[model samples]
Target: MEMEKTTDPTSFHGAYRMTPATFDELLALVGPHIVKQTTNFRDPVGVSERLGITLRYLATDMSQRDVARHFCVGRATVCKIIQEVCQAIWEVGAPLFMAKPTTEDWKKIAEEFNNQWNFPHCLGAVDGKHIHIQKPALSGSLYFNYKRTFSTILMGVADAAYRFIYLDVGSYGREHDGSVFAQSTFGKALEDGTLLLPQSPNGDLPYVFVGDEAFPLKPQLMRPYPGKNLSDKKKIFNYRLSRARRVVENAFGIMVSKWRILRQPIIAKPEKVDKIVKAIGVLHNFMREKEGLEVECDVGSESGMTDVQIRLGANMYSGAAWDIRENFANHFSSPQGSLPYQNDIVQRGLNI
Candidate 1:
């Protein structure tokens, strides 16, 4: 059934859950694709109306049935609109917003890391987020993770600016980050030397991503020193790496704050949840890239290291990867790379 034409455009706050300007601008960008025609029984739903429904669905996290009743459309129509809009967003969105960076892009990102965080030889920060969802019927413990809940993973690589460059969603929550990373194409590319990372800015450092210990170590991926026997140098490296990696955490925060859809356990099917996540992630990058820098979302710590992290230790990567980690560790101690606070903090002598 065609959705009843909204008599008056939904208020900036009521319809799309954002300022009218943002809604108009977003509609202008996407409206051409999602517009529908009015039929005889009902006036065709305008693009903004359909777009409003989708945005409201994401912003309010209201049940589809409720959204339908309020908008005078079938619940199925609401679902269809959501799926369609999300798909539309992904098609145009994924490329412009989340497409893999060019070689020059990577160099600029690396330069930012050096200037901003003093972490050299870094490409991006990588991490996995648990997107909670309803358990499938009679699925036993298949979806259950160590957190004792059903979820899927959102593994992503974030540049220095906290925008997602690559993402993989919908993997079972029961999996650990190490396992998830091992299976992902992104991981395989990074491991096999196909990621086309920029060479060491210093001529000695290989571009790498900073991640928590749950991620596997690779010549291209860096995790902090694990176990309690860390040296002062290791502590400095850990602190610096942790700093660069905070961008991912902030990215998740900003995502949750703006797209309240992700704040709760999503009520849709796992497959639908995947599109919703992708759409939301893509929208976030689009907004950041075009709409300007986001004020960090006050979403607290929804992105804290998950049970997946606690359950898995760092992979014992060897050969080039091991040597690479050592080289970075040494680099962090050098005068050219070391931040002033690293030494005092690593020594536990910095006092408030």
Candidate 2:
């Protein structure tokens, strides 16, 4: 028995098979009925098998040749299969994931921020993160960012419930958050007031968005004051702001974790990166909805309160009157004072 360790060719092939969940999700998106069947000598392979092979490759990080060899097809066939599957996933799931938040939705989000994070009169948190991508064949320098790394910008706005309202991709890796945002459609909407903020009982409660210190401070944009003399009020404000802002980080975590494809270096050309980014976002939304984890926000019909009433309520709390800046200064100067820990840092550090 010790001398006879035989390997079966079929056993090696079985290990490359796609999981049932992956196969079913793909078939559900692109029906098995419509998938082309192999027949003629010119036909490379069966659509179902090609799709399965593509899933296996993406899910396992296997090379194209590995997938091709497993499916007994050429590497070109594997490439085509990946493109087709990616396109299919995008077409079937895009609408399900990237929905525009309604007025009522915004209202609900505002409530969550106020209740959960103590950040009042906020509709959503906005920020940008980098997703590494293979360098473009034609314009390598365009996508490079200040970090000196090659990555595509993933700019998104998320509600307190962690639901993404808007997302943008395709920016060159070289752009900074502010620079990339300035050129984005969402940014333009914000500047033009087309993307209206929710009206609170306190005269639109002066809707504010939270971001990191890298972004400039403005009436609409709130960042922590960097100084000594950190007072209790400022510390509380920063703590609450950090809490609500973490939804975006959680969203990104779920995305990369579920789709390990994002964990590895994206080897596709820059031109195809947009599709890849969109496909992942769409998939993220779809999965969230399917799992019934989608957070519902009430943007309007505060059925609960009228806009004027909400504005009046917000006016009652003069956040500025709390001397937030003084509090911030005190906290930074204290030996024991510290910034809130971001989930991305805590979790990612552990993983590394």
Candidate 3:
């Protein structure tokens, strides 16, 4: 019997985090890559079973041994299957789901942020999350973080609809988001002016990615104003930026909420963990397209290395960067750019 016949549609979704039709579509895309040849000694597992096993492993926190038992397979087989299937998922699905955006795509993303989240000249929201993991052999304090956990960082750039546009995984957890970005491939591209970015709608102001206080304020990136402020204008800008930055947070939240494997420490080597993280991110975008699971509003409490500690990360900026931020702050408070509820939200003492 097929997996679908064994359960109802709701139960099927609960197990795989995708509807039956979505699973079939994903299988069609990913099956060819993961299919194995049958040997004369033993028959190969069916492609559907392989995909189902991988999805079950991701959808729940079940250990490999438990998953093996549930599927009536050996624990070693389950381990091998998950890694192979996750790699295939990333290779086959990433292009279709999370392809690199062009300059025009960046403009479209900014337009979506304005229409959906009310932030302008914002290409995307950037943030990082630590994927908890057990300490690696012979590695001490390298993966340890302020949260007192061993982890690998997964930094992502999220569009307004909570889809990941860019992702960098396998950074050590000890490094904060700002330093991680500074060292990331995306950061290097942005610094060297290779990454294609759309011009600002107003021309004078450049398009920027909104991040939390942990990120540096560059001409292309916007972080909130630090410390308690008295001026209502700064408060409005902070609130608006927070509202926009929340999309990345929600992206991470929805990923974790759907794929429970990230709910706890993933017991694997850092390299293996990298494949798993990338597969999860690619699958998230695929689900958004195939399953129509766009997150319209923020979900759960805030995450990432933002304001968790009393002292915020140092804000690295140049004079030009500061001027750009000031221009945005001024625009956010001005009549042309201001939202009617922005002032009220800031005045109501809500968390920005």
TM-score of each: 0.89, 0.69, 0.94
Ranking by lDDT: 3, 1, 2
Q: How accurate is candidate 1 locally (lDDT)?
A: 0.77
Regions of model 2 farther than 4 Å from truth:
1-26, 30-57, 292-352
Task: Report the Cα RMSD per candidate.
Answer: 3.3, 11.8, 2.4
Q: Candidate 1 — number of clashing residue pairs?
A: 1
Deviating ranges (above 4 Å) for candidate 3: 1-7, 294-298, 301-313
Q: What does candidate 1's lDDT look like per residue over 1-352, in tens digits? A: 3234334555454555455666677778788888877677876666877887888888776888988887788898889889988988888779877877777888888888777777876788888888888897776887788788788899988877768888898788888888888798888887787777777645558778888888878777888878667788778778888888877777777777777777678888888888888988888887776655544456335543253544444667878888887888888898877877778786773411
Which segments of model 1 are wrong by more than 4 Å? 1-18, 201-203, 294-296, 303-307, 310-313, 349-352
- Which lDDT tens digits does candidate 3 get at residues 55-153? 999988788888899888788888899999999999988888888899999889998999998888888998887888889988899898888888888
lDDT score for candidate 3 against the true structure: 0.84
Q: Comparing 2 and 3 by TM-score, which wins?
A: 3
253-313 per-residue lDDT for model 2 (tens digits): 6565455556665777765666666766765666665553423322211121001001111
Superposed by TM-score, candidate 2 places the C-alpha of residue 101 at a distance from the truth, in angstroms, of: 1.8
